[model samples]
Target: MTVNYEKLRRRFYLRLDAVFSVEELNKLRFEYLSSKSGLVRGALAALIQQGVEAEQLSMWTGLLKECNLALARRLEFIRERESNEKLTAEAVDVSYPARPFKVGLKHPLVRVIEDTRKILTSLGLEHVDGPEVEDEYHVFDALNTPAHHPSRQMQDSFYLSEVGKLLRTHTSSVQIRAMEEREPPFYIFSLGKVYRNDWDATHTPMFHQVEVLCVDVDINMSHMRYCVGFFLENLFGCAKMRMRPSYFPFTEPSAEIDIRRQDGKWLEVMGCGMVHPNVLQNVGISPDKYRGFAFGAGLERLAVLRYDIHDLRSLYSNDLRWKVS
Candidate 1:
């Protein structure tokens, strides 16, 4: 039985013309036009065995070629319409408002450190830094701390090796470094992390310190008082401060500083004193020709006081729930 290729072609065109999607149009085209087992392919296979009939062969060839071109045109039309619909659906509105995102607050400790640096720099202190791991000479001997000082005990300081090198307990080691490298008349301010072997509500094994040093002729307690007063007054907007006689290995006539809090409490802030003569001489500075004052305060303590923080551990808690006041 010979298949009517003309009827098959007409049926294909009718289905292809009616298809609204590229998928359906492709199926209709494949039914008659695909290379293997299609209506057109079956006609070609039959033609091969029966041999020649030039008129029928030419007619079938022309018809198959026309069908292929028409099906291609239909598939292209369906695909073009689909693409246009998608473009229209996804068009952006230039006038739409942008979404609002929540901004985060700076850590309280970071804010206090930045604020301190700004205030100190404005008060004639050039900021500097030093290595946290230090030798004993700079940290202890140059600062006038004796061999048997309680600070040298393993229970207090962290030792890296059997030798005297250890993690710096204060930023004063940085002060000694600057004095060793630069001749003064100079004011040096340093802010950095320091380590010790202590932990309590008011203390941590690791913490931050900010210290300032002034070395020049005739630097006295009056100059120290003026510098501290200017810094605190500007910092707390009229802070009331008091100094009490104290002691430190590095300083002569040492005093502990306390500032009146908003709740009428006197909070001890830091330790400061005139630079001891032996400390000056150890750094090759002639004590008879030059003198200086040094003061060191903890940044965590300042942050606590500045923001009325209840717990010192909160500074390093790393909780996203925490926010600066």
Candidate 2:
């Protein structure tokens, strides 16, 4: 079928002129030309050329240029307005609110550590602390970890120096320091940041740990079980636990402590065992005269298990929304 181009063109222009103001018509024209919609632009141009006067044609051509410039200016204005709005939103988000500011409370992880300390203190364990940056001897050698041990490697542990000084891989270093300083007939517990070369959903390169050590006369596996079981029950509000044989350089007959969750699955909570004779001897204590039991575990892992935290990194993320509730 043959198309009546001029008739169609006049009808479109008539409709456009009826509906739109001069400014809006100019915008529509610019949009049509810029979008390269050939039919619309050709139709409008043909109608303007054929029916319009010479002065009117010049006016329309000038209008087209003005429209293009106005469209460009409008787009820039819109972009600037959007950018200003985003800046305003960011400022509002970061600024203190107009309302009275409530003092920020302790972070959830800090509260968890404090609560764990309170529980340990009640159980006759004194809270102790040690350095985050530690020498190789206190962190590894004194703890009975051999030179060729996997934990001593740079990939698994964060070594700060070529000479092998590092961020402590566990708070167990506190126990080593405690043994060196205090002759232990008493119970000791420590909580602090430790570093390892690990990061994932369930691991962090830096995280907290709680370490417990009980050194006294008649301290045996049974005493170890009792103390650990009591602490787990009190901390989790559940009494069900099972011990599985494991290995640690500083402990003999090492067993990993697992507790039965509500789902009937066993979750390994920590590692505990009789302190190795060599470890005690390293600090000049005869293991034959004074036997002890020691246990250590990641505080983040316990918090994750207890609170159903899916990502271990979330504990340290400082995301207020994720942390608050």
Candidate 3:
């Protein structure tokens, strides 16, 4: 048996009117009539014609007019709601708090540096700094990395001028500068921004480095080992550490220090060794008379390893969501 489309449409309208209050029915009817679809228009027209044929023309005409008016009012209500929401959202301010703003605390990176500085100072190391932009001599040659060394390749160093004066590649250069200007039997710590030509999830073109160097007459490899081990234990709050033989131009018997991760794996944290005789000699210190230990590491690497940060870029990205004290 075939169903009559006109009968179905008329029945739908009557059922809607029976189930809904007059106001609700009128609102729904307005939506149906105002719709531009041919199907909706046809359905409405058929319902009206059915109502006329059924001798309810006056009732049907009143309902249709009410539906149309209700639709106009509903549209205005929606427009007003939208305008209010837009205005409220526009007026909202999400910026960092203004000045006299109790000025929020330091960035996580800075906090870590400050804390480390304090820890080192408590251990009798004096804090020092050097220029970010440095000459080739202090950055490379004075550190026992001669001009012919492969580590000075353009791919590794950021040469800033046609003459090759560039950003210091490591904080160790600061150690060199300090030794040149200060008398030793002193403990020194340096932390500051360093630059390289590398960028990746684990590396940035600019980042921070911290180094600790201690020089005196009686200091030896044992002192170097003990100092590094003590610092690592204090910094990480762990006593387990391992050192692997490593290579660095400025340090003799250089070794990379590794700490045990929570996951039972070891990760290299920093490189350290007894300062090479040549490096000391270049800085005008007699290696035979003065021996010291130098250790350096990327600050971000320590943060990443300690805090389980997966991306080095996040530290510098200024993402408020990730910022923490």
Highest lDDT: give the candidate number.
1
Ranking by TM-score: 1, 3, 2
Q: Give RMSD (Å) of candidate 2 vs. truth.
A: 9.6
Worst 10 residues of 1 by lDDT: 1-10
What TM-score should be assigned to candidate 1? 0.70
In model 3, which regions exceed 4 Å deviation? 1-106
Per-residue alpha-carbon lDDT of candidate 1 for residues 211-279, written as tens digits (9 for 90 to 100) = 989999989999999888888887777659999999998899899988997778888888899999998
Q: Record all residue pairs in model 3 with backbone atoms less than 3 Å apart, i.e. clashing.
A: none
Winner of 1 and 3 under lDDT: 1
- Put down candidate 3 lDDT per residue, 53-106, tens digits, no spaces: 544444444545655565566556656767888899888466956557344655
- Top TM-score: which candidate number? 1
Lowest lDDT 10-residue stretch of candidate 2? 1-10
The local distance difference test score of each candidate is 0.86, 0.80, 0.78
Worst 10 residues of 3 by lDDT: 1-10
In the range 3-118, model 2's lDDT, one tens digit per residue, is 55445445545645453244665555554555455444554477565886676556445545654565566556656767888788877644655887566666667767877888
lDDT of 3: 0.78
